[model samples]
Target: MLYVFLSICCSVIVSILLKLARRYSIDISQAITWNYSMAILLTWLFFKPQFQNLQAAPIGIYTAVGLLLPLVFWIMASSVRVAGIVRTDVAQRLSLFIPLLASFLVFGEALTPLKIAGIIVGFAAILCSIPWQKKTANRKVISNAWMYLVVVFFGFGAIDILFKKVAAFREIPYTTSLFFIYSLAFIIALTGLLIRVFNRKARIVWPHIMFGLILGVANFGNILFYLRAHKALASNPSAVFSAMNIGVITVGTLVGVFVFNERLSLVNKIGIGLAIVAIILITLSQH
Candidate 1:
């Protein structure tokens, strides 16, 4: 439980730092690339090379997760740009319904009435939170941010399912799985950066790089702690971690409103309320 709490805390802080970076003229792509590099290094430093005996199945699963690195960063950055941090986060978190349903279908995890109700409410919240305006007098006027939200939803959902599957495999060490997954992501990202460099469009923004380093360490903290927590509490670790959405939403909302000066419409407010209730119900159902 402590590990889970620490992971949630670190994730929240990372979000705040990422938002702050926008104010410093940081290049989002460079920042994300640097973040992944730092994450790879930090994960290695902590986990070391004790994962030499991990089975093939877990390695394959983590490799599939690594394939999502590029899409994940792109969609997350686009969502933040188009929908603002609060709404983007709401969309991202509420998308957990995808994995929940996937677990039921793939792993034969039974979904109780309470779980079904919570999932429905959560989906409704996400729908309400989406902004549909004819015209907006803002610089980041993205016509297809909703599409980016969908991408984030499915991308993260698949990643969660993969991680859960890897965790279920008894032969794989959790730390080893994470290290390989991240290392694969870093390799892919580095390749992309090199390609950009060859095109002479790879601008190195130092502030963004530093911010990415900070975010990388923070994100590593999140994954490390959560993996440890899942290992310690094998039964229904998803439910326990899912409950932390309340904390993420709370912190994201506060930061979005005060720091970013973002505003929510009435529908968005109602959506946030529904999400909160749904998260509470889901957590209670696990107990």
Candidate 2:
């Protein structure tokens, strides 16, 4: 339970850090690039996952995911910046539908009646939650932000599938696989950073580097505490899964609305209500 709480707090903190970054007009790509280096160091120092027992098959999956991590992360930061944390967080959590859909398609899992209903309602909720600004307002800004949320939803779901694959691969420990993933991610992000520098689109900013260090700590802490929660609640992993999602949604929504004054329409609020119901139905369907 302690671990669960810590994980939830850490997850919310990462979002908060991103919010702060945007508030300060910091270049998120640079921060995210530096984030990988910090994450790798923390993974090595604490997790100490063995790299000797590496397997080629799992490495391929991790490398592929590593490539997507930074790209999706940048999109997520953009989502939070434009769409606000509440909508972004809800879309991210509801991404479970993708893996559920993939399971039905790939593994021939039974799509129970409730699961089908949940998928339908879950998607409706996502559509509703998007901030559809009036034409009188900034239409392009609103539309672009909403699209970012859509990308984040599917992007995270794909990453979740890779995580499932990593978990299933018993030949290599997941921690070691994560180390490799982080290493790959670091290389990828560094390359992106260098490209930006060469193109003169961005400059080496000291403040951005400092912000990245903070983001890196929070980002890695979120993962570290989440893994710890699973270890502590191995008997009932669903508890961690449910609590983590709900907690983040609840906390993120509050922080977005209260702290940042992010506005949401009545329909958007209803979408959040339905999203919770849909999440429970899907989780229950698994059993």
Candidate 3:
């Protein structure tokens, strides 16, 4: 339970850090590239020996996970830029329903009435949270970047489902799988950095770079802890993941309101309520 709580807290911190990174004029792509590099290094330092006994298939699984890291971060950051944090987050969280459905249909996971209710409510909340409006006479309402948010939703949902499927395979240690994935992500991201450097646009702001490094360590720590919790409580990892989302949304909302002074409209307030209810339902359904 403590591990679960800590994992949720750490995940929330990732979002806060990303928001702060935005304030510093950081290049999100460069920061993410560096972040994965740092994560791979730190994870290897702590867990490299654990991989010695793993079978080959888990290595491929981990590599797949690594390939997803950049896609997830890039789309998420673009979503934040286009849709604002609140809406972007709501969409991201609600997107987990896709995996939940997949778990049921593909993995024979049972969906209780409460889980179904939660999914419906969560989806409704996400829809309510979106800020749709007509374009002004002189300005476009929805930017092209908003498409990235949709990608974030679908891509991340697929990633989560894949992770769960890999975890269920049981032939390899979870830590071994994670290490391979992070290492692969690092290689891919480094290649991207090299390409960017050749383009002469790869400026590394030291502060953002260091922050990304710290965030990388923290991100891997969260994954390590969550994997532990999932191992211990394998019957319902999705429930734990949903709880983490609740923590992220709660902390992110507070930061947006008090720290960033972002305004919440009446619709957003209602959406928050619905999101809370959805999380509660999802959690309860795990029983």
TM-score of each: 0.88, 0.94, 0.84
* Candidate 3 TM-score over all chains jointly: 0.84
Top TM-score model: 2
Residues 215-265 of candidate 3: C-alpha lDDT, one tens digit per residue: 787787788777778777788776676677776677667766787655566
In candidate 1 the C-alpha lDDT for residue 52 amounts to 54
Pairs clashing within candidate 2: none
142-200: candidate 1 lDDT, tens digit per residue: 67767777787778888878877877876766666777777788777778877887899
Q: Rank by TM-score, descending?
A: 2, 1, 3
What lDDT score is found at residue 200 in candidate 2? 99
Model 2 agreement with the true structure over 216-257: per-residue lDDT tens digits: 888888888888899899988878887888888888899999
RMSD of each: 2.7, 1.9, 3.3
Candidate 3 residue pairs in backbone clash? none
Give, for candidate 1, the lowest lDDT window spanning 10 residues. Answer: 133-142
- Superior by lDDT: candidate 1 or candidate 3: 1
- How does residue 5 of candidate 2 score in lDDT? 81
